[model samples]
Target: MEFWLRVTRSQITKEIRAGRTDTWAAFALVVRLFREAMRKRAAGDERLWGDLLRYAQDVVDRTPGA
Candidate 1:
């Protein structure tokens, strides 16, 4: 199998199945994604970043754990 470091649903799963993905790296990407979403939705001061993290965690949780 090929080694891909990119962060994507398919790539992550493939790497995980192939025993090539780093758990920290995948979680870091998730955190970065949550940050990006929060950065874009900068509206009236509200707790959206936490929500984004929760949502991202939910998505990760749905997949097989590391």
Candidate 2:
């Protein structure tokens, strides 16, 4: 979870730093990575998954043009 969060933050930061006007693609990458991780592992914790998704959504909502 921490790894995914860090990756998301890094991706978002990178996109913003590069002066990109759109960040949905970066967020999509994070979501895809998280989903892949969930598929490969047991990923039975619904609470953790919800928290991560909510966090991602909040970030997206706060970001401009995301």
Candidate 3:
């Protein structure tokens, strides 16, 4: 019983770590996408649109600091 409890806790920790990694990866992706879109627009692409704003808003909405 104790062993299983320890295992469960370990698994939960691993899952949480994985989730954090995923979150960072997603954030980086959004930022890059936003940057690329902006660059294209600056260069007169006209069709480049929509990116990190929504994701950023979500971050602000959820963050305790916000």
Top-scoring candidate (lDDT): 2
Give candidate 3's error at residue 49 in angstroms.
Answer: 1.7
TM-score of each model, paired residue for residue: 0.36, 0.38, 0.45
List of clashing residue pairs for candidate 2: none
Q: State the lDDT of candidate 2 residue by residue for 1-66, as single tens digits.
A: 899688878978888889884787767876797786576456565665666778879999999885
**lDDT per prediction?**
0.68, 0.75, 0.68
Q: For model 1, which pairs clash?
A: none
Where in model 3 is the C-alpha error above 4 Å?
A: 1-18, 50-66
- Residue-level lDDT of model 1, residues 35-55, one tens digit each, is 776676776444676777678
What's the C-alpha lDDT at position 7 in model 3? 75
User: Which ranges in model 1 have alpha carbons more than 4 Å from their true place?
Assistant: 1-21, 43-66
For each candidate in turn, give its C-alpha RMSD to the true structure in angstroms. Answer: 9.3, 9.8, 12.2
Q: Which whole-number lDDT from 0 to 100 does residue 33 have in model 1? A: 75
TM-score, candidate number 3: 0.45
Candidate whose TM-score is highest: 3
- Residue-level lDDT for 49 in candidate 1: 69
Candidate 3 has an lDDT of: 0.68
Q: Provide the lowest-lDDT 10-residue window in model 2.
A: 39-48
lDDT of 2 at 3: 92
